[model samples]
Target chain A: MSDKPIALDAMGGDHAPHEVVAGAVHAVRERGLSVVLVGPPRVLYEALEDHRATKEVPIVRADEALAMDEGALASLRRPRSSIAIACHLVRQGNASAAVSAGSTAGIVATGRLRLKGLPGVLRPAIAVALPTLPKPTLLLDAGANADAKPEMLVQFAHLGAAYAETAFSIGKPRVGLLTIGGEAEKGNKLTRRAHELLTASPALHFVGNVEGHDLLTGLADVIVTDGFTGNVALKTMEGAVQYAFTELRNTVNAHRAARLGALMQRGALRDLQRRLDSEAHGGAVLLGLTGTVVIAHGSSRAAGISAACQLAADLEKGGVVTRIGERVASTHRTHRLW
Target chain B: MSDKPIALDAMGGDHAPHEVVAGAVHAVRERGLSVVLVGPPRVLYEALEDHRATKEVPIVRADEALAMDEGALASLRRPRSSIAIACHLVRQGNASAAVSAGSTAGIVATGRLRLKGLPGVLRPAIAVALPTLPKPTLLLDAGANADAKPEMLVQFAHLGAAYAETAFSIGKPRVGLLTIGGEAEKGNKLTRRAHELLTASPALHFVGNVEGHDLLTGLADVIVTDGFTGNVALKTMEGAVQYAFTELRNTVNAHRAARLGALMQRGALRDLQRRLDSEAHGGAVLLGLTGTVVIAHGSSRAAGISAACQLAADLEKGGVVTRIGERVASTHRTHRLW
Candidate 1:
């Protein structure tokens, strides 16, 4: 719906090139979205021909790609990487947004270099939408700022609130501080200070502290914490979910009766699985950037890539950056504590 | 096995004197362990009479009892509380260990106030055994110290290693510091410093850094972290498991075939559930204390209480506290950095 198409990094992700190209084609055909695949032109051209749609999706040539195992230094080492080229496309107004299932550190470093930050933004945060019941819960600072000042966390609340309002269409989204206890005085120094600031800020609809058990209870629209804590909590939950599913599978196949039962209830089980899937919510988002950037999971398949494109497009169209700018502008006028 | 009985707080947990008395009886009759019920004699006597266990377990008199919701301050307020009396009994050598299905903060506070700490031990940590495949993983500092120093983490590793050696009979337990990355340099100030200290300590078998996702993979025998992060990680996994089982139950009830299959696989499902059950691990153990102390879940029933008693008895017999004292004494001699 924007003037420019979304630029997809075809050389990113665990199953790069092949799965990425297939996702691009699927998005074009199924969702009626315009996409530009950025990678080696010859490889992309051949893949597009194999999909039997060479003319529909265009390819932009990029000589190199950031390795999956590389860190922030990769952004500098491979300036012409597919992810870098995608960011360049967004910066030049040739693309509405950028989506990549690449190394998070590399994507973040390059995004900052290319798109830069909006005015008054201290640091960009990664917000992952948890597939909780009724509606999804957005957890911010998933991994961007490993060490954070109290002001950064308060800013994350504003950023998360804006994303929740735009993406989930919620009015005055309630923001909760992720800490050890329900009381405001709980948690380490960073969380305690941030809690006080968030409470005083008129922009965020601040709720009391929330524990890890509240993540799936849909207790808050936005949960804010330091990147280190957030990242640990997220990964721990993900791994536990996998373990539970494994146990469930082993139990279901224990006997003929359970197997038959599992087959009959297969529809409901699949629905629940889809609802809880991380890909359903797209991926972790980098907030506070000048342009919309979505970093999909490194192991994401075609479905995840398509959802990442959808998330990037929706964020751009919804004016998330403009909303953040307005919030920062108002905070500057009223509170100068930070 | 020891000459002394395991003390149980009869007025603790959701089920109160009834479940506690029943659990004490079960520990004696089923597990061949001696247990003493600590509470008001009249209240405990009547409950024991109801279970026909009046003659099986001995009753210890305590004038006051700490409420399940009461915290650290309760130790000062109710000096004669059942939990405080249990700790006193252990210190007096009348009871080899203390087990309470009560507030973790209350138990930790009272245990510190009554039993004191081993020499050279900085702070006590609560270790929970995670039911990972192949073996149970021990996670320490599980809500004992909300704020910890770098040196405290290193000490925690030593404490956890001692526990793993004594309880699981492992020659040299592998210790992992829970952090964001496997690389040594990828954490906040606390973890970074702790990693360096742990690596340098000759007493522990340091296995470098382990991420949150590695909690259930049996990657290490002992995982050491600050109490706040450990509690969050543990509770998050518990919540996710609950959600998964709920979904599984819903799917099984979706149709007749699934229901029949679930019925057929009932034994295997129950076995898996029992293996993953928190109560089966016999609650969290308080290390670095002068005497063995186990804190059970607040909602624990008769079975969970009995398991906690079993854990307390096992730790006391295995001389977990003695092993910690030896480790601390050696670390004091060589690793004077802490």
Candidate 2:
């Protein structure tokens, strides 16, 4: 990771170039990291000028932008979209990584088309860090491959394990299969087959099947599942957290004594919220690709964008892409499903 | 539904023959619901005597008992298991409904084997009422069928709709297919086909696809999915709620002001907990069967067991079984997959 600037899609996310430019300014001034904003020069230059960071961060021109509501087809519809240009910079070795808060489908499609998957990698997986006690757990195939084969699930385990090792610096990360039951003989055909394959693989520290309740328990360092299940579980957790806080707020506001108590412990509650915040963790990372890519939340502000930039830089510095490539190649050869 | 007693599996659950017996006593003595305890005569008699309701609740002899750890196979291995006897009572019209705080797999297997599926049900599904705002959302195939065909998903929709109609008194409940994306074109093969079938049916109030975030948002009255995804999503929500409360407790206890506020708002917090507690909702109902059966949590206490009994009686009294039978038969005939 030669001091190459991280390429960011300034036109992506709900807040657009303003928040994205502010984040780049923060990364350069506070974090001392090089960053290149990819979007229309006129709009980005004004955004950077608003933060007085015109001289600090560089700009790359991208004519088209992918809309938040757009899907994978938008990647082809807009060839030089902001996210596409960001990936182009990374693929061309002009940038260390690509960070975007664009539509997940568009980013994933553009990533696959531009950056391409690593050698022997079946498909790219979206790895999310679950805020858990002791250490955060990694869940893979968050939404990248909705319909996956048993072989793909095994590949996701390898991808997730390598990610946990790189991001969290864990040794021999324990991987678990996410299914309905905690038994080898349980689950649908795909998981049951994947469970057997995972157990047989000497390279993986495969803990047996873990249920949905084990997601936040830190029972496994990395839990692998199909993209559909992973996406649903991850979103379900987000919804639950949001609902709990909403109910808590209503309860606190209903009584004056409770309100005073909440006000007094507001700092502690804020700390707890920060600890469980997904956006604070830099969103999900797209792994098994040639270059590192971080997909921040669509509603991210400057702080979240900066966090995503830091994560992208960290992964590039840690050589996560190379790690995943080696692990996939070695494990795929030995544990051939065919 | 007649004046027949609700069959209670006294040998099931963690605190079996004691908590189950106590729960039966409460139903008979307080709720004025007729109850029959099914288990070993000696053990049940002792439990009833402890509750001082030996005459209030009748005892039905069942020598064999299904262990809490046993899965579907136990239904066959122990043909005369307490759960089996409870189902027998229902089939013989001696009991209006069967209620058990036992292993979900064992209850589902025994229910299907003894009570049997109604006219056109592909398989029995576990319908759990999610503690959502305004009204509880019904999610089905909680863990019954790990693998389900597209046709089965449609059947689940009908079953869930019927349940919402009977339990919540909702007329023409909206049905949503649980999938990765909100668009009808977004999911895998099974959901894609199910969406088409759901849209084509005149009997269904199909509102299109729903993501995991919609589970607690009350966007749909009945959300249907394959057993594997539903089980995972339901458990994940439970885990998230538990984790949030645990973190909140630690945060509140760490500070004096927070502790005071928590003490002041204790009543409201307890109300919120009761609102979200799955056991309070009488656990998951095994639907799409000939008889009304409620499977309480395996770790249920006396209160939870009593709640399960009340739920079973309510469903029996509401004629939910006949309602589901009519819905399934009509919809299955019109939307024949074959």
Candidate 3:
């Protein structure tokens, strides 16, 4: 088992300390991973006691708690909040990584503000593993910064490439720029400039422009875009998935034959469901930070939280942060971006 | 049955005269709709003969043909092309409407240049019916113009609202400006300004900003957006649907039980598939034009073309163009953008 510990924000997410504590217990007992729960001691103790895991899990008392509604300013105002404290633990070497199922914006702001970014990094990007055909494709800038320069997108590509290589163990991951069309000159000014920069960059395996359809076909291992388009694309895909599954469920329940078929196909359906489940892969990771930070979904349950912890541990063990810093530094040193 | 005739661009679309001729025949025989094939008479005659229905479908002689590869400039240069000829027929009272499975940009440009816009309209908007839950949702400015000012978006909303009310029969169709979030101040500069303009306009049923997720949920009856974002969102949704269905097919075929279930649930599955199929909706209509012009998919088959013809007939019979003209004229008379 790994000796490295993860600092988990127990007061965050929809289910709060109960599900968070239960998830931590499962990670400790089943995954054999250590976790430091950072939240109000009283509430966390009660939650841990409910799972009969008081002695098993350790609580790092953080009196201040940031609500999910809090914005980026909350990170500055409440420096010792649960999520901030979690990041602080990682910064102070008390924890190897930080796991939080909080507001994406809040987590990103806190992570950047608290842990700070690595040397030579322009900006941190949020990379999400989309379960596509054959393999899971990594999409970056899921919702980090809304406005991005062409140079920032190129940096995002490098960050995504390093992530794919480390997290998925893919060799020479192909990076593709998300655009309206596959044609070289088919997007807005940003995409056109990014395409030119990406193609010219020797550090990345830049495959040309890829349309939205290519997101789930494993056309490229690492897909990079500005946060605005990337976030919209990701959310649109999620919405479509939910709508489809809802329609599928209704169709399956429409008649006796469908019901019987649904029953017979339960195993395969479960497999498909599991494959598409965002929670299974954990939430998106904020890359370019000094330490690994995994941000699970706000609505995550125990299983999702456990999966997030496992992902955070795996990322730490995989040397993701160090690899990203090295890649950025090497690229900056060799090829300067004007 | 309706006595009005539709001018069909026979030489357009991927399959061209073959599918176009077949779709015309199907419309006459199956849907009881009248259509005049606008293309080279000899080629259309040969195609009609192959379908064994030369006498069933009438052919209109047009010497020029618009290649699918042609861009917007081709609309001005190739004045007598098939699509232009079709729109000309509509303008001359020879046909009630025009339907073409040709180049979308060419069709939009030709419709505006040839048929012209309704009085008081800024620019025509392409409105596509997205297959959302419960009912279909209408999205406008799919690709009419790449860049749009805030005033243009407000006009597009009116255009979409007119379409939803006339075509979908939705009363007071709630209009939404498609953006990154539901907040009034959550999008880019254009969207922010568009939101304010839409809310202030009494001509529309402005419901604030709706995110991409709302596209599939029928949150708003008429979704308005700038042409670039709308086109991107539409294509993204189409690509996502294709990816999802592909993934589902693989999952269904992976196991024996799932295969058995697939057989039993085939009917419901088919229904769901048809609902999600873009072709089933009879392509996107370029609204705010003087005459009804339906731009079918470039890769449309016989059924899709026939559906487009039927849609054109329906819109024409419903007096869509007249209503749109009145709406725009009144809105412009009261509150002029210029």
Candidate 4:
């Protein structure tokens, strides 16, 4: 059991204090998880009072909060921001993990500066679980280091593999290098060199290369790429899914028979949507940090926030941070790249 | 008017020779387009015979063929390969364009080497039409230059704009920089720098930065990015769509009601698939080259090949290569980055 509560940034995300407070209440009441809301006292208190859960969750007062539109520089400028304060709580061992739905840039930048990286972590990465058959595939450096060296990619592979092993209980997770082609030689200069390093590393169960199409096929348990490519790929998948659903809805509406058919299968269709929802997976986990950190979707509502808190608590309980530390340390010892 | 036939690579793709021959036959008989098949005479002649159109479609003898598994270097090694021969026909003024359902790397490399880049073009890029509403959004650097200079991105904008204007009849195509965030400063080093250059260029109606989610939303008429990210985004979209459909199929089959509904709406669902098919857009076009080139999907069947040939002929007639030449030259003169 986690002794420390999850430090939640109440003022982060588009929904802010209201949804965040509701989510905190749900986590405490429904999920039985300890959570500490971090934001301006009066605003958060009023929001929590709306749900009549002021007694259930504790408050860590922080006057300043990073705006949703603010970028990474805001992390440095607004040191007392809600996200920063949440990170501060985790750093001080008052909390087990930091959960935020603010600007990804701000969360990543603040987490790096506040919680700091693990012993051998070059850069903290964002690891996301992609919904796939059998189990989810973990993709990393989802947006942490936009520009990455070949060595950083090798570290990402380890980070992703360790997380998959710890989080999904998969032994020897097959690591893959994401690039343009399935062939080893096909990619940009960065990926080409990274492929060579990944292939040479004995620590990983290296699966040569996986194309973008392979991301959802469960071809590899852990797929590693630079933050830029990873971010684009993630967003592209989001957009594609949204577009397809829109098209499907339009198709169902175009004809009388289709409409009747869709009505009959409505429950099943909704279930499929729920299974593919990012919020259900607890958003994206920021790996390689000194403490457990979960960055929920910026547009997350009450349910998403609650799911993120649950994930943060689960990751803390699973010892993902320590597992990552051990894996990185062992790999570094064998490879001597660091 | 296109003066010569489109040079088709017969010994390319998974269903090579047979499907390629059938497509060529379809182009001549159905689409009213002229096409010349390039491959081994004995094999191609026999393939043409199977279609019973040996005399209808002419054959260009090329003893060698690049295997589907071959990469860019294969373009250099096998000068007589079907794809290489197709490019040679375009270079020699015997064909108006080159059409191939071959290895993209082999096609792009051979196209660059044989057909060559235009005078002001920095690097030739592959442009694909995304299946969106109103009109398809054109995404470039689809797989051409894995690595790109900021200046090269400016050239891509011009290239894409010209193609959109000529191909889609858009007088001023709005160009968007594909990156992680919608803000100008939100991408990696390459995209950030490219954003600055794209914003400064007067030749483009640059609408500023767009995210992966915007790819299908039709926010911008032309979206430009480095080839690595573009290729990944494209494939990711493809994978996501395929996965969604697969899940929908499972959802439909899960319940008797859903199955009955799906049966009733089968026609509408099939129509939806056709609307989103890559083959319907005539595959992807290689721009900024001296000669027009079309690279069909590697697994293209007769219909895909025919669509690619028709697209190749249309692009040749539209003078996309010349339009791109003028656009790049004008931008280079104004910007002076090259």
List model 1 lDDT by residue over A154-243, tens digit each: 889889988988888988898998888877777877778888888899877998899888877889999998888888888888788778
Query: Candidate 1: misplaced stretches above 4 Å?
Result: A255-275, B255-275, B279-281, B336-338
- Whole-model lDDT per candidate: 0.85, 0.87, 0.82, 0.86
Docking class of 4: high
lDDT (10s digit) by residue, model 1, range B217-285: 889999999888888888888877777777666655655454556473556566677668753245689
Location of the lowest summed lDDT over 10 successive residues in candidate 4 chain A: A256-265
DockQ of each: 0.62, 0.75, 0.50, 0.81
Query: Considering every candidate listed, which one attains the maximal DockQ?
Result: 4
Question: Against the true structure, what is each candidate's TM-score?
Answer: 0.95, 0.96, 0.91, 0.95
Error of 3 at A293 (Å): 2.2
| Decoy 2 TM-score against native | 0.96
Q: Chain A TM-scores, one per candidate? A: 0.94, 0.94, 0.93, 0.94
Candidate 4 residue-wise lDDT at A113:
87
Over 4 Å off in model 4, which ranges?
A257-266, A279-281, B46-52, B256-265, B279-281, B336-338
How much is the lDDT of residue B65 in candidate 3?
A: 81
What are the per-residue Cα lDDT tens digits for candidate 4 across A272-330?
A: 77668763235698889889789998878888899999889888888889888988898
Report model 3's TM-score to 2 decimal places. Answer: 0.91
Best-to-worst ranking by lDDT: 2, 4, 1, 3
